[model samples]
Target: MANWNLKSFDDIYSSIAESAYKDRPNSFPKLFNKNKSTEIDYSKSKKDNEGQITKGGGTDLPNGGKVYLQPDSKKLLEDEETGYNAYYVTDTETINANTHQTYFAIRGSDGFGINLPQIKKGNFKEFNYQDWINNDAAFALTDAIVPQAKYATKGMKEKITELEEKAAPNAKMDVTAHSLGTMVSVQGLAGLSESELNHVGKAVLFDGPDTTASLKKAGYSDEKLKLLDKKLFIMSILLIQLVCSIVINHGINN
Candidate 1:
């Protein structure tokens, strides 16, 4: 039940410095150079019992602009050799744009690496601690994703509540996710205030297998159900496109 509250850009960077991927598989070899770069020691993040600072802290995105975490990524400390690693990515170009900042938690297995599942980045923050545990991926899959469902649920609710608390009386927010993450996202959305729900532009989802039963019982209108079906199809196609790119990337990389 590891819970992370990423409040700043520094928080995201610190996690990456300590991640196992930096030294092992080292996915970004172009920057890390197969863990052989002399200028930077990825291992320093693991070794420093106290902590150290490093320049060029940002998540390299497929797009151009550099993403920063809340407290700076360098601030997050981890020891991958002993199984501790996490990171977050957030776009800085936009205003209050939580969509660009996504959280990731990676683990090592038997001297190998683990790829975290994709979790949707949102502005939600208000949380129901108990409900999150019940809906967390750790409770569902338990094998991979952590019980982050609560953090994510609370995060989104916070996002919506904060928005209403501030300006934008008419603006809408949406909650969406795939698989295990989807369960918590939807639960939080369901728990939002009616005004929050009204402000919710949409609740998009992808392969949220656990929530179908819930949605069915909630008794959505025919139109709402149709919209959900359409959204599902669109998400499925988008996933297929990404999956294809992954297959191609693997072939090219290997």
Candidate 2:
């Protein structure tokens, strides 16, 4: 059994950065695949590393916005080879409207990109360890989204909400994200209504920050959702030490 260590913040950040879906299809398969087949090293984050996120919605929406499922018609996705805008090519296998087993895959945040037009134009700081430190510190201190994470969160919330709407009843929505995206997903999920939260299931976070408290914070204030009682299985990749960790249970009335 291997145990992935979160000793350095870089260890965590690098895990996510490497797992991101960039111009290459390099990272997604490993993240989405069962078992920890790939163990990425926590090398020092560099200014030249490939950015996983793609900017969308432009200035019309605050912070240039983010999109989870943009139509192929919009040509928002970038081509890995040409660096030109491209359309999303749907996988015929993922969606089956009539099937009994429905899996709604809701994407989380895409970490910042350096070559992206948004970054070049100076819309915000490149999402890196420093950025996370600043955002997390401000959030822990103020219980508010820092100016740095504000736009990022707004876009994340909007995209996640859209996916939630599509999921509806009888669909199991699983969230997958990396790096700052893990933070964005937690905040977005916490803001969801009790009904929406019901449709969501497990979330697989790669190299994420401390998210143990997120479940306790989710759901409507009036709803009695028992998320804390669920079993949390952490599969550490360094040695693949698989263990079931019980989440502390707490009732709403308390």
**Using TM-score as the measure, which candidate wins?**
2
Candidate 1, lDDT over the whole model: 0.36
True-vs-predicted CA distance for residue 245, candidate 2, Å: 22
- Give lDDT: candidate 1, residue 3: 21
Candidate 2 per-residue C-alpha lDDT over 165-200 given as tens digits, one digit per residue, 9 for 90 to 100: 543335454454444444544554555555555555
**Reference-based TM-score of each model:** 0.37, 0.41
Position 203, candidate 1: lDDT: 47
Instruction: Give me the candidate number with maximum lDDT.
Output: 1
